[model samples]
Each structure stands twice: as C-alpha cells, then as structure tokens.
Target: MACLACLLALAFVAAEAQQMQSNISQGSSLTPTTNSTWLSRSGLYAFGFYRQGNGYAVGIFLAGIPEETVVWTANRDDPPFSNNATLRFTGDGLALPTAEGQNYLVKPSSTPSYASMLDSGNFVLYNSSREIVWQSFDHPTDTLLPGQRLLSGNELFSAKSEADHSTGIFRLKMQNDGNLVQYPVDTPDTRPYAFYSSSTSGAGENVTLNFGADGHLYLLNRNGTNIRNITEGGLPTDEGKLYLMRIDVGGIFRLYSHDLKKNANWSVQWESSNDKCDPKGLCGLNSYCVSIDLQPDCRCLPRFEYVNQGNQTSGCERNFVADACKNRNENFTYTMEELESTTWEDVSYMNLRLSDRNDCIQGCLEDCNCEAALFDGTNCRKQRLPLRYGRRDTGTSDRALIKVGVPRKPDTDPRIVQPGNKKKGRTGILIIGLSFTAFGSILLLISVIVWWKHNVWAYKRMSAVNGDLELNEGVALRRYAYEELEEMTNNFKEELGRGASSTVYKGLILGTQKPVAVKRLEKVAAEGETEFQTEIRVIGRTHHKNLVRLLGYCLDGAKKLLVYEYMSNGSLADVLFTRERQPFWEERMGIARNIARGFLYLHEECDAQIIHCDIKPQNILLDEFMCPKISDFGLAKLLKADQTRTTTGIRGTKGYVAPEWHRKMPITVKADVYSFGIVLLEIICCRRNVDWSLPEEEAILDELAYNNYHTSR
Candidate 1:
C-alpha cells in the first residue's frame, strides 16, 4: 500500500508540472467586459484584465490566493481603459488597442511566436527559436517572486497605497555598485538621501538582488557568488509554501510568505525598519515631526500658526509681525517668551558670551534683527527671521527666547478738541473728506493691479517649472543660485569629507560670514522632479534641537547641494574614540539621554515617523556646548502612519545592527531601541562596539555587558 501511494504522488506531481507550462498562440486575447483570463498550469497565477479605477488594467495576479493579489502590472502609470479595450498577443507584441491608440505593454526585440503565464508568476513572450523575447520579470513594478532577481540599475517602486496600484513615493533600487538602496521617489539618489542600503558595495559589479526558491532573499554577484544574505535564514522548504519580496505602500521593503493549505493568508516574514519617521523630510518647513501612539503628527512652534491646517505637513508661519526696529518709543512693546528644554538651527548671526540669562534677554530685546535667542547657560546666540528645526526635548539645556509684540492699551482720554470757528471747521472737514475719498479710490486701484500682477507672475513661475520645484507656501527656504554657492564655498576650496554619495565643504554665508557646511550631492535622480522638491520641503519643515538643521538648498540643473549649520565640535566618534580622556560618567549619561530624546522626537514627536537605522557615534555630531545632534540620514527608514513594521535589505554598520536584522522577523522601532542600547553600552565603556585588540570575551561590548549581567546575577 505504501509503494502504491508513493507512485500515485509522483504521477500527481508530474501532471501538475506538465499543466504549469501551457502555450498560447498569437491570436490569443483577453477582454475586461467578459472577465477573461489566461491561467497557469496549476491555476496558481493568471494574466488578465483586472478592475482598476473607473476602467480596467492588464496585469498578473495570484489566482489561487483568495484575495487575488496583483504581483505585476503593465503600464501601471497609464490611465485605465474601458471594457471595449482588448489585450492581444500578436506579431507586434502584447498590445492593448483602444479607441485612442495602440498601447503596447511590452515591445519585444524580436517577434514572438507564443506567450505563456508561468507558474512562477512570470509572463513571457517567446521567439520562433524558443528563446525569451520579453518577460514580465525583466520589467518588475513592485514585487519580486521566488527565483527572480532585481538586476543592477533596476528599481522596484511601491504602490501608491494598499488600495491603489499606481506608483508611490518610495522606491528600492539595485544599484550598479553592488548595493541595494531604498529612497523616496523623486529624491536624489545620493547616500545622504537613502533610507536603507545593503552596504554590499565593492562586492563586485553587476550584483543582483535575488529571491530564492527556498525563500532566501539576498544579493548575488556577477561571478555567481552569494555576496550578501539579506535575511539571516530561509523559511522551511515546503512545496505548499510561496514567497515574494515587495516594496510596500509604507515605503518599506518586505518579504511575505503564504501557505496554501494552512491559514491561506499572506504574512510578513521579514521587514527593513519599523520607525516611519526614519525617512527625512516627512514634515514641511518650520515644523517638527512627532509620533502620537506610533502615528506621525506635525506641530507648529510657539507663536506660530499652521500654513495649511488641513495638511499639517504644509508647515507653519509667524502669527505676529516683527516691527522691533520700527521705533523704540512706539506703542509696540517687545517681550521675550521663554521655551524651556527647546533647541533649533544654530544659525545665529550674533553670539554674546554672557553668564547671566537676563543679559541675554536684554541683548535680544535691544537688537532689531534678533527674532529669537538661544541661551545655553554661558552663551546667548541671537537668531534672525525664519527659525528652523525647533523641537521640544528634555535632554538639552538650551532654552529658546521668542521676541513677541505686546498689545498697546487704548487711550484713556476720549474728549475731542473744540474748533475755534464753526463755519471754518465745517468747510475744512468737507474739503478733507473729498480729498480722502479721491485718495482711497486711487489706492484701491493700485492694490487691484498689484494683486493681478502677483497672481500672473506666480502662475507663470509654476508653469515654467511644471510645478516640480515649487515648495509649500509655509516653506521659507532660501533658493541660492549656483553662482551664489560657488562664492559661498570659495570655489569649493575647503574639503570636509567625501563620502560615497556626497562631498562636504566648509563654506561661509555670503554677507553674514557665518560658517556653514555645504554638501554637494554626487548624483541626482531627476526622474521624480516633483518628488525631489517635495522631499526638500519636508526636510526644510523639520526643526529639532537634537536633529541637524537644513538651512537651505540649491537646485542648479544637475548640481544638487544642501546647506547646514556648522557643528564646531565635530562628531561624537572623534570625542569618544580619538580623545585620550573619555567623557565623565554624568556627561555620558546626559549624552545617552540626549540621543534617546532625539530618537523620541524623530519617532514620536514628528508628524512623519523616522527610524535611524544606522545609529553610531560617527553619525552623531556635537554642538559648541557638547550637545549631541543626530546626523547622517543615509540609512534611515520610514513607515506609514498605521504601519509599525517593515522589511527590507539589511542596513547599518555591522556591529550596531539589531538582532532582528539577522533574524527572519518583521523589524519595528524596537530595532532602533536595540541599536540605542548598544550605543549606551559603548558610551559606558568608552570604546567601539567591536575591538579585536581587546580580550576575546570583552571584544564585543554588548556581549561583554550580557556576560557581566549574568555573572553578577
């Protein structure tokens, strides 16, 4: 009986395999009106017309799955067609001929004799020689099936949302440098703009990001060597299980698994990062990001109002005018509004080293250009208009002083002066009234003409850039020309650091002579022009004491540059690893708190959730006061408002990577928390996370801490 059962099972497997390879002739076609489809041999996948928007779109979907999930879409950005349209496989390739025109979803290099929808979720067009002329896998929209590879220079863009299959804001690219990177759509493809990366550069060129049949997602080099394993482990090898890697709607790369006989639902097997705020530029200018119960929330600073109340990310604007220099004896009285435990962009034009807080306040009150003041105990730094990156933090000792105008009291005396001659007064009053009426009419006419011209000019400007370079009305970023940047940086003379994606240079503000850091991005992905400006606006809007401030940006054709306030004390790594004297215990504890608070602001306080995937001493910079400011957003990750877990290629420096990054599990904010814990341990030890020079047992800081804890217990 056992031998007979084994024979039957073998026969069944052979029959299913035969059924999975069906061929379609050139005349084959599908129509949406009849809900027609071409199914694979096992009926697990299908290629057909699916309902989209008000019409229909041609795509491939999972037929065996109850939910009918779409894995690949052709011409995803094209508007849906009516039922009258027919998708036909012909000598001219796969064309969807509509009343408007002939839309070829795939134009084969050679004429195809037949087409097939393979069980592996791939749709192919074959030439007369039986060689593939075109395949769906070659032009992937978002998902990668088992046995498929995302080739070098290829990218997978997420859907607009779960309900919409249109291209979204996030993208995952298999770079030619053997690195897999994730970035916001339309942003520059530079290291500083990336949210996640495989960090597999120099592993050899033409590296392919692959998903194996055994459910292992990894990178493979041109030499056929497995360069990097994205997931630490693979799923249990079973015939009934299927897997796919997709860049999800929440701007995260994720691996999903499904069981045919079990629950019959797709479950998250692995994720990239959990914190949604990890992606920079989540909010508009003059605003900071915070998370409320894991949801992103944007809040305006003190005395500032939202530019668009309905869209909180649109940023904020000052509610009161700054007329401090109008006249000292004028009725407008200026007062300092104190904000405790707050910090912002340190772009102070004037700095007064005063020991007393009262003197700082008095100095700001006396200066006409001082819109805000930052007092860090010993130094009072006076800031000008358009304060950026302002956020509340309990870790920093910096306090903010905002200059506000006080309302003047109405005059107590109401009595009017009596005229000397009644007839003379009446005649004078009549003459004055006629003259006033004439002047008011002329003023109204001038105002109307000015409004018309302003609107016209704005419309022309919007049209000129095709609305791609325009920022939100609340954004107050200075648009510097290429010439201005050249002058500021002294023709790019002083080099700071040259990273993989950008080169930093020390520069001075033109007239102010204020020191600044200029970052010149090496590459720009102009495919998403509108998205680039949108992300720039988001970066401009974010204001936090613990996060680095983006003072301005310049988009001069192919040259992309970012301006930031200079950090006088350099990076925390320099202070920790290079210096002979380590920070005091109290100072280390304070630094840890500041780092945690900065992450809190990024994760919980901002409207856009952010996760700093690479949290290390080198990425943390110190201000003049030795306060830690989080920098380097190259490996950050973002999540949607309702999302808390995401999957993607492994990111971060090796020693600081979280265990979940190696484990086959969905990563959340806990991953960042784990990295933070390791950082804390490093701070306590005043050493690197890994040091081979030390004894084997004490080489790894986290491992050492674990052993010490257990031994003490």
Candidate 2:
C-alpha cells in the first residue's frame, strides 16, 4: 500500500512538470496553465519550455508573431536531463530544476528572486529585493535585441564561431587598460580594431551616429581628424532573430531570428563614440594630434613625430615658444597650419564673433595671458588658459586665433568732430532706408509675379482644358491628377501629419517638378459628401501668407484632397512634441509671439474675421525661413464683421481645447489664448500636454506655464 501511494505521488508530479512555463527556476515557480493564452502579459513576449535537439530548454518568445520565435534563453547552455522540467519565480528570482530532482539542473541561489519578461524582450532575473541579479543581456549567446545593451567594460566578451554555437574569436568589451575595444577574441592582441574612442585629435575630430525614431541608422566616423561616412544602411534581420544583432561564440556576428512586423522587431540605436585622435587638447599636454586616412576610408590621428611622430596614442608638441611676455612688443602670433584634436582638458571655452576678429587679435596681443581668441559669426570668444588652441567638433564652436604674445596701445592722435556730420548721417540714413524699402518691395513684387505665373495663369489655362473645378476668387491653385499625387507621395508614403479633421503628406506638386505638402481627409468618416463640401466651401475662400496657401484640391466622388504650399520645415508639433530637435529657446518664444501675432491677424487684420477653432501646434507649420504658418482651416469659423466672438462646437485637440468649450460657452479669442498657452508650454519643455513620462513637477501644463512665465520674467 505504501509503495502504491508513492507511485501515485510521482505520477502527479511528473504530469505537472510537462506544461511548466520554463524548464528552469531561480526561486519562483510558474505553472503551465492554459488559463491565459500565450498572450498573457504585455503582449510583447511569452514564456514556455521547448523540446529541441532531443533536449528540453526554457526560453521567452515573441507573443505577437505567427510563428513561435524564441528570443531569450533561461537554460541556454544546459538543458534539463529529462522532459519533466519546470520553472518557478519566487521571492528570490527564478530557479530552473528538473522535476525528477534538483541536482540534475537546479540554479538555486542563496538569495530570493523574481523573473519577468520585459517589453524590450529581455527576460530579467532579479534577487529577493527585485534587484537585477542576472539578465539574458549579459549572456547573449548570439543576439542583440532592441533595448539590450552590451556592457563594454574592461573586457571584450566574445561569442562562438560562425555557423556554430560554440565559442568564437570576436570580443566586444573594454580593454584591460580602460579603452573600449571591439576585437576578434581568438585573434592575437597584435591586430585588434577600434571602432571609436573618447580620445581624438586635430582635423580627425569628426564622428557621430544618429538613429532615427523610425529605425533609420547612420554612422559618421573620423578619418584621422576629419569625419568619414561609415555605414550605408542600418542593422539587418535574419531568421527569427529579427530585432537583435548577436555575436555568438563563433567569430561571426549574426542577426538572430525575429518577425519584422512584430513589436519585438524594434530598431535600437547605439551611442556614438570618438577616437582619442578627434578632439583638440584631449591629452591636456601642450601638443596636438594630426591624423590621416587609409584606403577603403580607414585612418588614424597624428601623434608625436620625432619622439613618436604621427602616432595617435602620443600627441604632438611644439619645439618653439614666442618671445617672453616681458619683451611683449617683440611677440608675434603664428598659425599652426594645423588643427588641434584631442579630448578636452584644462581648456577655456569661448564664443567669438567673426566681426570681432580684429578686436580679438588685438585683445590677445594686449593680454599676453589670452592664449586663444576665437571669432565666429558676430561674436568673440577668448580663452585665457595656456592649453587653449584649435577647433571643436561641437556645432556651437566658432573660428578662433591663437596668440603667442601681448599687445600694445596705438601711437596715433585723435581728431575733432566734423560740422557736416548731420548732413552725412542723414544721407547715409536715407540710402539705408531706401535700400531696405526697395528690397522689401522687390521681394513682394517677385512673390506676386511668381504667384501669378505658376498658380493664376496655370489655373486659367488648365480651367480651359479641364472642368473638374473652378475658383471664383483669384487664389491660384495647381491641379493634380491622382497619378501625379501618387507619384509625388511615392504612393502615400505614410502620413507625415494628422489633425482632428485632416491628414497631411510629404509629397511633390506634379506641375512644377517641385515638392509640396498635400492634405486629404482621413478615409474613415470623411467618406460622406456633407463632410467634404463643408471643408471645401470654407477653406477654399481663405488666403493669407501666415495661413497655409491653398494650392489646388480634388473632389472626386469618393476622394477628397487639398494641396498646399510645402513647408520644408514641418509642423510645430514635430518640433515641440516629437523626437525632432527642439527649436532654440528664443525661437520657441518667438513662435509664441508669432502665433499671437498670427492670431491677431486672423481675428482682426483679415478682410473677414476668421475664428481658428483649433489653435494647437499641429496646425502650425514652420516655413523655410522658420516662420509660423497657420493651417487646417477645416475647423475654422468665419465671424460676422460686427461680432467679436461666436458660439462654436467643441473642437480642437483634447488637452488644448478650452474648458469653457466643453460647457457650450461662447468661443472667444480667450479660448485660443488658453490653447496657445498650452502650445507654448509644450514648446518650452518639448513634451506633449498630458504626457505621463514627464516628472510630476513638469507633467502639469498649467503649472509649467506659470513657472516658465515667472522664470522668464
């Protein structure tokens, strides 16, 4: 009887182990119950045990893919001895043990643990207190997924050789001496390659890498001190490891299998690096590095020549110094006919205006201690440290001059003022004003001429040929066939922007071989004729430079399209809320002023007052000159000439929509004011109105507005 009871218990345990989440456990346990579909948690990943190579292992796979593609492994190196394996996640983390016994494979740690699959596709193992104890990232057998980072410390960890899972020769870790190095692990140290470094010197001071929000990848590296193009394309995908690029124990780096359409297929961007030879004064000593390139676009920076010339590791120095400061009059400045490129240290940062070059040189001469004076644009920057020399790779850097000695006072006399000053000054003033006025008039005249030639005349001629539509007003618009639009957009190359009522595209105008933006209603509810006619009747009659110019539009039975002048610089929302560069503080504030000025023009300056019901950043476009242009008139309301305000439907973006509008209060200019305030705050912090990612302090727009206003004041 006792033997039968033991047998029954064994059977129960064996049956339970077959469907466990993973064949491994740290400290917790997960039963393989179908109570929830594999799409259990974040929908990004799933957990299960796989029977492969006659061995069973535990791993995570993409939940969104049609095929089960495993991305992370729990027991990658060691599979369970039997098919009866189970995984558990407890207070300590995770433990993988065979149901038969713990000895065969029990990753039991003394600490508590918890295991979870992250949205980034990494299965993390944390200790009792939830601190990461071990992660799939460090043990990447052969894959680099988005959000996974290879820790480049003082060692280059490598993967197995190509075509095999066994260890290989490639290494990607920091060198023993503290430099970041990526080398073939099995290869002798005699021939290790460097992709980039923190150290750089003269003309070789160029290198950068940018990953677009949409997964576009580019590499800018340095050839000695100059920038060199590195990559022709972004990371590639292979097999099921679609998102990660993994370097296995084999010498070859492979893209692990992944599904391109799955969220797991996100592209990850790597941080940029600079070799020590790209920056000026990187070594801190009195020398610089000069580097040159090799074939196939390879290069190195210049090092100390005689003592060690042209070697990037050792910087170069001067054998001569100018006459002593005491004999200041005999001192002369010399141009190195070279650039200093080295990591910065003991340096004085300055900004010099180009117009102040003469003054800057004289200032360096006047002060023996002024080691360097830079003049770029209209500003001047003077560096007072002895370590001052050369240019910077940073875009904000200015042109500069290095001085070796002190300057002296002028030996000339002053003269008296002339009696003809008033007449001369008046004549100069007249000439300047007349010149400016004439220039403005000419510009206006050219704009009128261009408008008439391309739009008005073309409209007249095309009207004679095609009778699709005609405008009563003289607002000349170019007509385009569907094929022309299709060609211009590369077949609707993803909507560049979308508003509450319309979607905008980055495309070209078929007539003039010029690029232009096109706006068409969404394919959703906009299918109705009522929605179509309402938008056309209102926006077609409007004309203002600050407003987006209405090129020609299409009104096919099922299709509704409107063409507008292409603003090379896109929308304000992209600048203020998306991943694009944030406009300068001055520019943002100026945009605020421009919006206000634009609103004033729409409400008061136009022949007919138009109430822009929607005044969000998405509806404002930045022109070539970075000027603000109001757009999306589908929600605009024309006010009576005598009426200052009007009652309107609840419209515009939710966060920016005025509180009164929801209560059906009359829409006043103040509603636009409230919305403008939100847009202004969005510009200042470069975030959306209700973004939860922002800290609690900056999350609330009203508070930010008040604080920013007070701070600016």
Candidate 3:
C-alpha cells in the first residue's frame, strides 16, 4: 500500500511541473506541416517554417509580440526546405534540419530533452531536473528582449545583412582581458580595440555590468563597486515599456524598449556605436570612406568621394577606379590616422628619451617588410605586427612609430669632418681635462637608469600589449576632426531623411578639400561595431571611378560618421517616379548595365559571396560623366564561398521583393537577376509595377511585364 502511494506521489509532482512544447511529442521528432506554427505557454515566443526566394527553413519568432521578432534559430546560416522539414525535440535538444537531409547543430541533440521560456525571458533546452543544455540566450540576432543577458560567456556573431541568415564578417564577444570589444573577422589579427570596458575603476580586473532593475546598465569593477553606467532610460517617453539591451549582428549594441503607443514597435534608448559606412570595409579594397553630406555622423574616411550613396548601408569606393596592374600608378596610398585598435601582429616595446624626428626615422628604416612606421616626434619604433596598427582603447594620440624599409639613406648620413693633426693635439689635452670633471660618474648613472626603465617597460608591455615599438610618430589622415565636422555642417543643417537607425545630413570633406555628403548614425550596442569596421575596410580596398568614393571616417566615442562625394541628382527612384527625373532609354539601359557589372564584381570577384537583398533602380547613381554607379549596400551580403544559399528575414519593398522572399528560400544570384528584370520592365513600360490607375486585370505586372519576368524562366 505504501509503495502504491509513493508511485502516485511521484506522478502527481511530475504533472504539477509546467511543461512547454511546440508539438506532438517530447523526445520525439516534430514535423511542422500543412500551415502550422508553435507557440510558448506565456505566448512570448514561437517557432515554425518560413518561405523565401526559393527555399524554406524551420525558424523562430516571438509570441504575443506584434513584431515577428526571431531570437534563437534552428536553421539560420542554412535553413531547411519548405516541403517536409522537421523541428524535432530529440534526446539532446532540438534538431530542425532540411528535408533534403542537410545537417546542422542548431541545438545539439544531447541530454536536455525539453525547451522552455523562463519567466526571466531566457529560452533554453532543459534536462529532467532543469539544467540547461542549449539556450536561445547563447546566440543573438538583431534584438535582445528583456530578461536576456547581452554579455554572457563567449559566443557572439554579426547578423547576416539585415535580410540573410548566413554568418558575416563581424563578431562581438568577450576578449581575453575580460573587456567588451568588437572585431572584424577579416582583420582579426589587427585586434583594433574600438572600445573597452573594465569592472574596476582604473587598475582592477574588469567585469561586465549588466541590467539589474528598471533603468540603467553599468560596467563595474570586479568588486561590483565603481560602476560605469553605459545606458540609461530617462524621461517620460520610455516609461511603462521595459528596456532590454544587447549587441546586434549588424555590429550595434542598442537598448530596446517596446513602444506601448504604436503597436508596441521597438524604440531605441541608447547604443554603444554608430552606423555611418555600415562598417570599416563597406566598399571593399583600395577605397576611403566619406560622408555624402555635411552631416557629422554621416561621413566616411579620407581618399574617397560619394558617387552613389543612398539609404542606410553604404560607403564610397575609390575615385580613380585604377585598373588592376594596368594603372598601377593610380594605386597611390594616403596616410591614415592610426586608431586604438588591434590587428593581428606580434609587437615589442622600447623606451627612449626625447630626441629629434630624423633620429626616430633612422631607427625604423632598418626593416625589409616594414609595412609602416610611426614615432612621437622623438622615440623611434618598428612593428612586426601585421594587418594593422594604432592606439589602445583609451584613444591615444601621444606617440607614433612605424616599420618602414630603408628610406634610400640621404647621402650616407653625412660623414663627420675634423681639423687636421694640429687640432688633434688640442683635442687630446681637452679630453684629459674633462675626464677629471666627473664625466665617468655621469655616464655610469645614465646607463643604469636606461637599463632599469627598459626592463620595466618590457614586462609592462608584455602584459598590456602584444609587443610595443616606441609610440612617437604616426600616420594621420586628412579626415576632419570632430569639431571640424560640426562646423562644416553648421552643426548639421540640412536634413535629408531619417530611418530605423540613423539620420542623414550634408557636409564637406576636409582632406579632399571638397564638398560632400554625410550621415550621422545613432549609437548602437556592441553588435554593430564589427560591421561598421568591416564596411570601412571593404570601401577602403575597392577602387572604381563610377562607384561612390569613400573620403574618410570618424570614430570619436559614440559620434561616428562617414564621408562621401555629393551627387547633384538624387536616387534612381527619383528619376523613375518623377517624369522630369526619368532618364532616356539609353540612360536606362546604361544604368542596368552598370548595376549588373557591380553585382558581377560582388558575386564573382569579391572574396566572399555577395548578394544585394534590396536591388532597385533608385539605388543607382549617375556621375558627372553621366556614368551610372551602383550604390546602397546596406542589404549587401557576404556568404561562405562554398554554400549554395543562406537564410534571412523578409525585407525589401512590396512587389519588388521576390515571391519566395516572404518565407525562407534559397536566395540565388538569380534573385538579383529577378529584380533587375523588373527594373527593366519598369524602364520599358515607363510605369510602376503595381498601378491602381490601370484596369485591375492589367496592373499587377502579370499582364504587361511578362516579357522580362518570364525571360529567366
């Protein structure tokens, strides 16, 4: 009788525990079919299938929230198919692979059999007694809802271009030193320390300070004492809405609070970085970043001018467009201001008393592959570190050193001359007199001091930096200073527009000594910083005359801007929509050809797979030569060269977006081809894709634009 009662008690306790499941069975495969969706108990999240260009995948969504926000995903970089995919709760976690039988460890199938959404908002796969096996909190996309910790252990990555689900060049995670920083994958060795945080005041071990209550998030010392509150929710506008913050895949860390007033749309309270050029490598190679207008935040780096800068994700290419090896002379380089960042390189540190600039240069001139050299106008330096060089996270402007090859040795150091033997006799007498004046004592003291300082500095740098050269002189770009940008924009006068994350303005570039356009981006969280840097690097490498030129970029704390050349005419959209702005037939074809070439370069020639999610004529720009230039890469994507396709959320304007776009699909180079065909039809008919003015039967492009649309099929 007692044994029976014990069994009953065990069953009762199991039944009392709250259970959260998306489908038919626990520890069994869940195949989503025939128009189905799964939701959590509190209705805080959901998981199911979605369709896109030509494929499908098992995906996630937030429940109860109006915004179809996706947090943790089963098939992000590569999604499952539309026909018969299964989101199975296996012995380990959840396995939602493609019906075609492709494999991925979305949630490794091991130990934890159950997945649940905790009241704290963290969604995880749990074991029998509730130990976490896998959790959505580990991997983040664009947003971090409340109850989720932004900075945890060691996993972070940039979201694919606002649309795609493939991995990107940017990454956000913890550093060995325990501070938060952003990194660009391509420039990993450089270790550019764009930002840094510490738990303690100045000398203690660093610790992450996260959100605790209703308002702020801070970074305090290891002791939890000296708090550095980085975010705050002030004013009545943010009241009532709970705020959650995290770094996004786009290289931004933003504070999100659902707007109770407008369908609960998310609002940004603050961010850690900005999105001017989209990132450090926006254009590709051999280019500079420039702001298109006078906007401070909307500027680029130097050596570039804007040709086709429209909308959010863009930067400038090179002005000359030097042909490969053909116009080798055209690849001349301009100096860039060293920044406090890391690039991959081994470094060593040395100290020297104040000296002349020439002496410093002479010191660094002794290397062969010395990519660069810098000095603080006194001490000389040479760094073997590759990829990049700059100051540390504290915004150092003090010293500079460089590693450069022999500077041809101006006339062999100028041999020293001396009077003949007559002077030699007098010299010998003078030397003997000075010997008694305590010269030996002075020399001994100087040697001892030098020895002690060198050892001390060597040990210090080993701990603080990889290695160190002298921080004396450094390369400086002609880019405008933060103050100069403010003055140029008349403090940001003409406002062109505003969007989900940034604002636009007009400004002038300083080094080029020309007028340009600028965009001032609002601050982002840690997630967006890597993308921002990458965009800059891409733009810096690309060189094309017709392409928008990147003049320069500025990263002063939260104030980030990109500079670009000004285009007299607006976007291709303006030209197409307004009769007066429309170009002639020849011009239209030229625009098409130009855009195609740009796409070809991105898709075929770029180091990675490039896809333009939002491709439209409006993004095309015409230069003084009337040459068309493709612009606006905010939606541009980079894929692993081997992959056939990637996953992403739905983006782009209506009608123009592909049919499979609304759901998960294999977005191919054909996707861009499809949009181009539509643009061609618009050029042919001289009308919009969807027009109410036309007879209902004739408007949907189904009746008139078949020639181009069906051409591909």
Best by lDDT: 1
Query: What value of lDDT does candidate 1 attain over all alpha carbons?
Result: 0.72
Q: Which should have the higher lDDT, number 1 or number 2?
A: 1
Q: 458, model 2: CA deviation in Å? A: 42
**C-alpha lDDT score of every prediction, in listed order:** 0.72, 0.49, 0.49
- For candidate 2, the 10 contiguous residues with the lowest summed lDDT are 457-466
What TM-score does candidate 1 reach? 0.49
Report residue 705 deviation for candidate 3 (angstroms). 80
TM-score of each: 0.49, 0.33, 0.40
Q: After the best TM-score superposition of candidate 3, give how far the Cα of residue 384 lies from its true spot, in angstroms.
A: 15
lDDT head-to-head 1 vs 3, winner: 1
For residues 664-686, what per-residue lDDT tens digits would candidate 1 score against the true structure? 57876667766766676666567
> How do the residues 1-713 of candidate 2 rate in per-residue lDDT, one tens digit apiece?
99999999999878654333332334334434322212324465766555445555566666666555555555455633344445555544445545554432224344535455555666665565767666665555445555454332323233332222323344544333323334533222222133334331222222332222223323333432223222233545333434445433422233343445453544323323223333222222334333334111112212212334543223344444444442422222332122332222322322323364566565444443345554554644445433322224344434435553223325422231111111111111011111223224234323332342233212111001111222333222344566666777888895778755567788865434677787777654643344455445445544444667666666665667778788888888777765656877567656766666566556544444566778787789999888888877667665554555788678777788878899998876566656765665566566787766879887776565556545644
Q: C-alpha displacement of 618 in model 1, angstroms?
A: 47
> Which segments of candidate 2 are over 4 A away from where they belong?
1-476, 499-501, 523-539, 578-580, 704-713
Clashes of each: 30, 101, 156
| Candidate number achieving the greatest TM-score relative to the actual structure | 1
